[model samples]
Target: MGTKGMDQISEKKRGKNKLKSKKKAEDVVDDIAMDDKSDTKHGKNKLKSKKQEAEEHEEQLKRLKETQAEFFEYMKEHDEDLLKFDAAEFEDDADVEAETDLEDNEKQDVDVAKKVNEQKTITAAMVDSWCKLIKEDAKLGAVRSILRAYRTACHYGDDTGDDPSAKFSVMSSSVFNKIMIFVLSEMDGILRKLLRLPATGGMKDTIMELTNTRPWKNYNHLVKSYLGNSLHVLNQMTDQGMISFTLRRLKHSSVFLSAFPSLLRKYIKVALHFWGTGSSSISVVSLLFLRDLCIRLGTDCVDDCIKGMYKAYVLNCQFVNAVKLQHISFLGNCFIELLGTDISASYQHAFVFIRQLAMILREALNTKTKEAFRKVYQWKFIHCLELWTGAVCSYSSQSELRPVAYPLAQIISGVARLVPTARYIPLRLRCVSMLNRIAASTGTFIPVSMLLMDMLDMKELNRPPTGGVGKGVDLRTLLKVSKPAVKTRAFQEACVYSVVEELVEHLTQWSYSVAFFELSSIPTLRLRSFYKSTKAERFRKEMKQLISQIEANSEFVNKKRACVGFQPNEPAAASFLEDEKKAGESPLSQYAMIIRQRAKQRNESLVESDVIVGEDSAVFGKNAPSSDEEEDEADRNEKGAAAFSSSWLPGSDSKEKEAEEEEEKKKPKKRKRKSQAEKKQVEEGAGEDDVVEDFVFSSDEEDDLFDIEGDKDEEDDVDDDAADEIAEPETKKTSKKTKGTYKTWHKNYKKTKNKKKARVA
Candidate 1:
């Protein structure tokens, strides 16, 4: 049984092995099949690619053959066209040819040479005649062919000594000019027709050649005729939508300007007139041409042209008002150039033009009809004011122009009102300069009161009275106020100081009566404050130096011719009292005493009321009756006895006198309360309580007992405690406070305050 099992197992193993062998053989066969399939697919793709490439090659060959055929056909057509023209048409007639041959042979030639020369001449003349005939055909193609033939004949004539061909030699300027004139005149219609066609290569070459020659000198008349004709052509072209013509004409005119100024000027004038009357499209071109002409001719000639333009527009015809204004503006720019020149000869004319321009501008400004001045000169009004201001300020020696002072000032004030923010420093400077000049002029100072008043009224009308005023006042308002307008307390202080400085300076030279009285009359407190506060240190120094110089040169001051007046009454002792009162001080009895004493020293008459002695006594010391009844009579008798007792002995001060004096000394001083606005400002400042740890005491305040003793002990304690807390935060806060305070104080502080409130809220 075991043997049998072993044999069966071997058989099973063999069966399994056989199956494995069969599977391997089948796998190999499938792999061979896939390889063969892949080969077949690759072969098919190769065949397809070859077929496409062959088709492409064949197509390329076909295109090549077609191109070749087309080229040959074109050549054939051109050759046929060339052959169709008979050579004899270009030749001279038989009689002329025979006479030329005989003359050539008779002069210096062998018979054969002469015959060859005659044949060459005949051929050239034939070419020339053919070209002429072709040009007459009036076709673009025919004309180009004729130009080519003429060029060829001219080229061939360089080597061949042909008598008729000699006509193609370089023509002299005069001869060439004449030929061009004849061609341009007689063949103008034909040329115009040709110009409509696309530009041929030959046409461009010929134009360039003609332009470069000296034909301008000899052919000026013809050139003018051509230019006139060109203008007509340009008009026609413009109608037909040919902008190139206008551009070409402008370019040609630019070149022509250098050679023919006078002619160019005439044409330009005509063009300007046409432009003025013609379409708006022509205006830009005309303006450009005129600008170029003006630039090329320089300023003098430009000025002349401007005058001419003005005459042409304004004086000659009844131009449309719009057009007339346009022309005026066009000429107005020439003033800039005229102002730059040294030629005084043109000044009168220029000034006249400026004045007229101003009138025109004024009229335009005041015009009821808006359309009348819509396109009128916009900048002229500003420039007119500028020019007037400049002129008034520039000629300081010309005092005869003093009459213009008020008018010019009025104009300046008006402009300042009109355009306060105009970006013209020179204009602003001109206004300043004019003021200075007016001040220096030997004329009465024109009170700018009305102008200033107008400005102030305008400001008030613009702004609400409850709101604080604007930061700066206009010059007009400043003039009217006869002082600086104080918008803020700081500004009021500054203005008052400035005014005081001016008044003090004026007072040192002239009398205080002259300076302070006029200044003090103005209603503005700022002006009065300025006059009162400023110390005349510089003025005093100047006066002292002047007095010393006068003493050294005593002869000049003492001379009879020098009209000296009495030394002005020492600034009227009463004036000081008035100033003090204006400064918000009480009227003191001592002020009256000083005044009376000065009057007595000067031996001037004084009124009793003008002097104050105590509260009830008059200056003459006569007893005045008391107005009280019986109690007044008793009190008066007691006071009178006390007064007599005090006067009897110099050292006698009774108990009643001492008591009265003590009561007076003990009386409390009245303090004025700050306004709500001022109180608010102070409270606001205190609310921003940013304490500085490292407090620095000012030198002036260091001597205070509270600051030295109390502050030092408290500061030391705070410093010791703050050492535990980082100092950096306190330092930063203090720095922020300082920077913020400085910026807020220096800038528009009120606006900043409002902003700060908004931010905090």
Candidate 2:
């Protein structure tokens, strides 16, 4: 206990001392942390207070400066003479004389200003006098006074109080119209006089003519005021004719638009509004003026022009039908022409639009949600695809625009595949048509045989038609069938006919190529399979005819290809039938024409019947005539229209007789039985002719057919032989190598390669 206990005590004491020191150190650290926290809080608070005070001081100073400015402006307006001083007192005699002359001129200007401000109304005579002064002496004073009045009048109702600089006091509507018309009409001549240039000088000449002279400065201010106010007035206009008139006049002054960049942009915005929402005549004039501005201003305004025009087109094309389709087509053509003006510049905008479309499509594909799908599956988006397709292909021969075509085609293909079912057959057909157009223009082959063949396998085709006779839906105007209209025989017939027509078109586009046989083989075989399996006699007849026509075209191309002396490996072989003019029309053109005519006639019949039904409803409903005679007259008119429209259809005699019998008998039971019999006939395929079992190509032959060259995505320059090819089915092992290659082009490969290299490094 002596030594051991002593060591134990020493150890215990040391432990206690360490614990006390550690606790004290912890307490001191806590106190120091609290003090530092409080000090930082106080510092932040002081800094914030200082900031607030400084901000408040700056605000007060700003308010004081504004007050001083307002006071000075008031003084200048009320008693401007008091602001002037005699600075020439220290100068020589010549300077004094010159100052005296300047004072006299200032007095004259004040007199002219007073005279202008005193006039309350602008009459025709006053306008004529001003124009005469401008024309005779090219007077800068007249220009300034009139432009000031015009600018003030444009904002007539904007302010509550009067403006001292206004030349006119009360600007009536008629007076404003007169001044606006005069300014727009005479702007060119006035600009020419002010710039001291001839009529034929370029915009650069006009801009260079400006100097430090007083007249030039005054002219600049006046012209800007006139142009800016013109845009303001144009924005408020609702009259289409007047807008057109104004645009027509303003287009002549586009040469000077380059000088005022901001005002020019505002004017383009206004023009785009009318271009989208105006009447046909108004839109035409607006587009013409836009084209002029793009040409006149060149790169300065072209970007805005293209972007605005595209936006307007998208907004307006949200609801296009057969009636508005022609106008939309014209707008698209005009847009394409505008792009062609500067393909290099247009490439940037085109790439953006194409990439945007691709991104939206990618999102839709990724999420597969209705909300996401709705964004891409609309008339606006479809028209956007067509528009960019035309734009990209219009300049595809040029390297600047060629790269965009592939990406745009990929977007179209993605949209077609987004909702690949019978319900979206019309949409699929539309996308395929756009892809076909791109391929045709770019000398690249897109294997759309799968899309065409997919349409044939839809279960909607084999389903029996409903007994009720509904209105025929136009596939061109619809993306998908509605619930009520989906079961109708008219939609079924439309789907079948549209599929056949699109297939024919797809084949015809590549018929003049060297690989026409390979291109037509898969589509032809699938169509035959569909023809044999389908129950509709009308559909079978169409498919059979289409197959025969495709075969004849293939044989025609084979005969042509057989006579060629060049080897298959040579460029001459690739260039065979490259010149379409020399290749003449495809063999399927006549068949395509006949199909189109029948479709047109069918649409006419549907429209007329719809009108008749609508009129009949109105005659028997609340809008019915009060007398029997009026009712009889309406019935007669409807009958006449129905008869006239029925004549457009095939077998008009049978339809006329049926219509007459229906009119004679008011029995519902008889009509019901007649509809049942018609339904039975449709179910049985009553119009069946001889079924041709011998197909042009067997399944074994299909497998042995030459492997198509197809499109490759490894090169920027598209090959000539890559014009047309039939891709193998996706399930085949060979297809794995070729998967998506036909759908894509070589534009994006290099980009992805560089990105991968960067990531690896």
Candidate 3:
């Protein structure tokens, strides 16, 4: 080797030396091979320990499994023996069928006791088997079938009037109650599925047939009893807030509503009897159930049920019961729903019944109850009226059914009649207010008019003897002495006014042209107008005083006028006199007079100077310029006079024309003078006509009484006119040149003549 090769080998040896040195450093720090050996050793130890533990656990499980199997086998054998015992308790189906056949054969032999004994034995055995199955297996289907079979045997026994043994009766009630509990427990599942199946039409026929069959009567009772018991349980569940499951079951049950009616009726009767006797909760439940039944069974069924219920209600005379009130209110609400359905005749009948109920409530209002009771009774009265109104609106027109308008009118009128004498003023007011509201909304003007007319007629028939008539009997005295006495005269008066106001308000808003036309013929307007005028006068006096105050305060006067858009005009008398004096004077007359006076003062000619004077005019004229000019001057004079006096012809004096002018002037003045003189006569005629017409047509007597102030105002106005006429003559001389100049001159002449006569006397 050369020196260079030796150097290369030395470098490579150094690199290899460095790598060996790094490996030695790493190995010295952590003993890498030893660490790996220890890790492998630890992993093997863990695996060996896990294998040993698995073997031990497996051996323990085998032992435990053997023991559990042995224990389960023993328990199974015990269950099997129990099942055998239960099976033995049940009469075999062959024996049961044979026994039924033997009983049938015995029935033909008239051996009723033997048949009863057999049925008792059979029912007892079957019930025992059911109890055992329920206790041991708890298979719902097996239990259900066994109970149904046992119930069927009891039903058959009941049909034959077979006397059941006490043991069997006890077992049957327990077994039935148990089955009911089981059914209720599974009701949500079973009933939902059962009801979801599409209905076949035959179920109704089957139900009808079962209802009619004497043999199935017992079955009917059993079914009803079962439902009754279940309902009671469900109610208890509801009270406890555990009703979710049961309510769901009831909602899905097909026969639940159908089966509820008979039971509900029975329950309602009993509940109503005990209603005030402290079973309100049960009564409430009965009401709710009946309401549900009405909703579910539809209108026809509900209507029939209500009719029967109403009879019972009447028979019991339970109208005074608050619970009855609640019950009837609920039934009324349900009937309202039925009214929304397609059946209209039934709804009309329902409305009629509601009216009857309202009448009963009206009577109850007179009862000596607490203030709250009276208030509630009043509310119920209005509620029933509102419901009846709604129901009537919902129904269609039917020929067989009388128009709902008349009955509703009567009910409202009856309440209106009652409210006045009702002890509570606020209650009376409330009832009357509701009547007014209903009258506004639903009452026809014709019916209302007729009702008002009838009331008025009754009033007339019952009116007290007046002074002119006899003995001066007032309405109070008449009512006091009447056979059927009036209650609450003040209330009756209030009701009358309220009803009148309602009628007026409705008539003002509703344009019943035909009814309005009929009313027009009856002379209600004069009476109504009189009432309005009287009422208006009271307002007018207040307003007049207010206006006078405002006028006294200039700022208020201006502000009020601005607010109300009022601008008072000049007084009529002053304006009339001012215009009258200037009537005959032309605009140009005044101007020409001013001009001529100025000219005369200035010494100028009134006429314009002409260039030529004609010889013919000098010969023929006294004051003519010329013949032709004279004619022209005369024509100008005539034209000027014509222009001023066109309203009256001149230069043609006819007696008839003069007399006509004189008559025109004289007649108007005379009429003005006599208008005041005739004032009382016109008023008397109008008043007499009004009173007689009111009596003839029998307009509302309240209106007649309230209208006195109005008639007095007319008389006052007449007297005021007479005063104005008396004052007219004193002012006549100052206004002599006016349009009434002739009348003014005549009045002045009469006054002067009177002064001369007084002086002579």
Q: Write the per-residue lDDT of candidate 2 for residues 1-761, one digit (tens) a residue.
A: 89999999999987786576556546645765775577568878664332343344345434533655544454466567744534343236545666788899999999987777556666657767887897788787788767866776566655443666544766544555556656766666677666675653355344645545566675676667766776776765555555666676667666666777777877888888887777666766676777777765678688988988888788778675655665677677767766865778898998888888888888877876656787787788999998888776667778998888878888888888877666577789899889888887987888887887887787667767742445667777667554335456877888787777767767777777777887778787888888888888888887888888888888878888899888766888767776652545667766777877887787666443233112222121223222111123355334333322211211223456678898868677788999999989887984344222111234442332221122122133221222111122434756765766744645577778889999999
Best by TM-score: 2
Q: Which regions in candidate 2 have their CA more than 4 angstroms from the true location?
A: 1-119, 157-161, 171-178, 204-215, 466-469, 574-586, 603-761
Candidate 2 displacement at residue 15 in angstroms: 99
lDDT of 1 by residue, 361-410 (tens): 46545752434332232233443454444444344345444345565665
Selected candidate, larger TM-score, 2 vs 3 = 2
Q: Give the TM-score of candidate 3.
A: 0.32
RMSD of each: 40.3, 32.9, 44.6
Q: Which ten residues in a row have the lowest lDDT in candidate 2?
A: 718-727
Q: What shift in Å separates residue 27 of candidate 1 from its native position after superposition?
A: 99
Give candidate 3's whole-model lDDT.
Answer: 0.41
lDDT for 408 in candidate 1 is 60
lDDT of 3 by residue, 1-761 (tens): 99999999999987786566555435532453464456468768764333343344345435534654543343355444521222232336546766788799978777876565564443445645765776577555554455444343234323233344332322343443333334544433332232332231123334444455564453444444445544544422212112322332232232343555665555444433332232323333343334444545556456655555445334433232222333443444444443432355454566566667655755545662333234333334455565565455434243323366456656565554442321223233333434444555554443344444334333322233121222111221011111111232333343344334434443332222212333433425333433343333433353243223222333322332344332234333223223322542322223334434643443222123331222121121122121111123355334333322222211123456569998899899889879977987887776233211101112232222212121334233222223444567867855765758788889999999999999999
Residue 445 local lDDT, model 3: 40
Superposed by TM-score, candidate 1 places the C-alpha of residue 12 at a distance from the truth, in angstroms, of: 99
Q: Which regions of candidate 1 deviate over 4 angstroms?
A: 1-217, 233-266, 270-288, 295-304, 308-346, 357-454, 457-459, 462-761
